[model samples]
Target: MNTLAHGFADGPGPGPWILFVPLMWALVVGGGLFLLRRAGWRGRAPWQQGRAALGEQSPIVVLGRRFAAGEID
Candidate 1:
């Protein structure tokens, strides 16, 4: 019989080893996210980065807002 009651009538199959799939996936995803954060991904928004890169005098930003407001073509 299956140790964790997860097999069929043909005796035990993978038993509890099937749980390793999810555990391994969790570790992989969590590790990837942690490494990404350590590599300088502090979750800053796109607009924040754009403003910091171009400063307050950027014409593209003003033009983008004007386009959104339909002020000019």
Candidate 2:
């Protein structure tokens, strides 16, 4: 009975080795980041300061609309 069932079914396939694909990728990415950090690579370029300063009002279009709607301080 068991021997007949084995003939008609798929065998247990590719065990845990398939998991190594993502594992290797994770290690590679982690290693690259580690090397970059050791080599003084700070990830992204610093953002340039924008022309707008803190505590500034919105553009004239927005201010005009707000004043017309009585929504401004």
Candidate 3:
């Protein structure tokens, strides 16, 4: 009684390996975005007092000075 009606056709196909391709792509893209953000750290960060020569204050410090000058309150 070798019948295809009740045979291997009912068995499960390949398993979780099919999910790896998109997972790898997502990891690669996420790491790329992280590095891109990290690369901009120098430009966005304020120059420290120890590092500044001409006395370049950070954006936050500049804002504080303006506030002290009655710009905000």
Alpha-carbon TM-score of each model against the true structure = 0.46, 0.42, 0.39
Clashes of 2: 0
Q: How many backbone clashes does candidate 3 have?
A: 0
lDDT of each: 0.79, 0.65, 0.66
Please report, as a residue range, the 10-residue window in candidate 1 with the lowest summed lDDT: 1-10
lDDT of 3 by residue, 7-55 (tens): 3554554345556778999999999888977877444445453445545
lDDT of 1: 0.79
TM-score of candidate 3 on Cα atoms, chains taken together = 0.39
The alpha-carbon lDDT assigned to residue 62 of candidate 2 equals 74
Residue 22 of candidate 2: its Cα lDDT?
89
Cα lDDT of candidate 3 equals 0.66
Predicted model with the maximum TM-score: 1
Alpha-carbon RMSD to native, per candidate: 7.2, 11.9, 8.8
lDDT per residue (tens digit) for residues 1-73 in model 1: 2365565556657766688889999999999999988987779975666676776578887888899999998
